[model samples]
Target: MLSAGSLATLFENTIGPAFDDAHEYGYRGEFHGSNAVMRMVLDEQKQPDVIVSADAELLRTRLPEDIAPWDVVFGSNALVIAYGPDTAVGERLEGEEPWFEVLSEADAEIARSDPDLDPLGYRALQLFDLAEQYYDRDGLAPALTENLVIDPQEAHILARVEAQERAAAIVYKNMAVDHGLPYVELPEKLDFSNPEHADYYAQATYTTEDGTTVEGAPVLYNATVPSTAPNPEAGRAFLKFLLSNPEMLTENGLVVTDAFPRPHGPVPEEIVP
Candidate 1:
């Protein structure tokens, strides 16, 4: 199993138990974050039986073409402003006020991952851009970006929020809830969770290189099996189990996506189902 930061707690506390419950029944799997999973797959170093990711795009971009084509959207998540009560900025933004104002303040500190490497980082940038439009603030994106110090991995951003090292951090809704952190909710218009707004959000793009741009939307988590997987049969079986077990996922604080017939690339036919 592979995932992003917030899901770590859920996987350990919830999903791990479910797998254990089925362990005697012959269900066994290991979970890791998307970054580590991707590196392993890309390097052809240690090909696990299964591959799941917090972002589907990683599979699209990193995996070899000969790998399985089909990718599934088994779950979904929304981003939110996360902070603790002890945080100086969190304390100040406790009421019905826009978080951008507090975040833009000169003394405020913010944290995020590098967009170039992590989808969370890119989504953070998109959220700021959306907030700027919603609030009519001209420099909101730059202001938020300027305040941020990038962590090497998306998971570390939560640590910064929990440690109160930063005033605020952009994180998934489930993460904030799981950590019991105080958060200011962004309007659904800006919260990328609503698929109806996907087209609108998707229209917004962030330029990575000088002239290259990528469209944006709510960050999506995806999964696939690699061609090099030593136990392709086991990978497919685990994928099937993950898709069929919505209750297991909800116990982990995940919201399953209704989208079906998940996209895939050309791979072994045996594992396609």
Candidate 2:
């Protein structure tokens, strides 16, 4: 299986073992940024039984029709400012002060993943722009951008925050929860959590240094079995189990609200509940 780095813990520690127990079959997973993994599949010809992506649109648009023609949107996540408790920003985050105000006034360095490599990275940039609009503050996004340190992986960004090597990082809420790090939740409008706010989210756009433009949208997780999967039967079985049990995602600190198991393209009917 190939998966987004954000899902490392859930897949490695829980889901993989649980599926093995339930169905008498186990699988190995290689986790990284969704785009990077997609590149591996396309460029390096590394085929996995299943491919799970953090960005729904990336799966829908980037992975060609001949490769992974169908995908199911199964889970969602929100962004948060995860910090080390010992840091100054962390101290204020625990207080009654508004999160955006604290972030705007803080002088500490902030870490983020590379927008070109990871969805979380681009989503962080989008969140900043949304925060600017939501807070009605001009130049807020630029102010936040002024102190960023771009790490190429979300795992590394969250690791830096946890180790206090950096004060904080904008990361997926599950990453903070998985690492047991302190975090302040941003507003749903800024965090890309509320699907009803899709139009508002679309107003925020981020252009990567490499020139790819990502428009803001709800943070959704997508999964599919590629056409050339080495173990297609196993892939289909696992996906069926996943769609049948949405509670596994909800238990892992993701937002698996009513808008889940939304199948796209020519998904196999047995896997689409």
TM-score of each: 0.84, 0.94
**lDDT of each residue in 1-273, candidate 1, tens digit only:** 545555677666766566657644334344444555666667776667667676776666666567746676677777788876776787778864568777877386777766665566677888888878877889887887788777766655677778777777887777777777877777876777776787878766776532335566655666777677777676676666566677766665567655642556543445334
Backbone atom clashes (below 3 Å) for every candidate: 5, 0
- Poorest lDDT segment (10 consecutive residues) of candidate 2: 205-214
Which whole-number lDDT from 0 to 100 does residue 68 have in model 2?
86
lDDT of 2 by residue, 111-160 (tens): 88878777888888888888887888999988888777887776556887
TM-score of 1: 0.84
- Candidate 2 residue pairs that clash: none
The C-alpha RMSD of each candidate to the native structure, in angstroms, is: 3.3, 1.6
- Candidate 2 lDDT (Cα, whole model)? 0.84
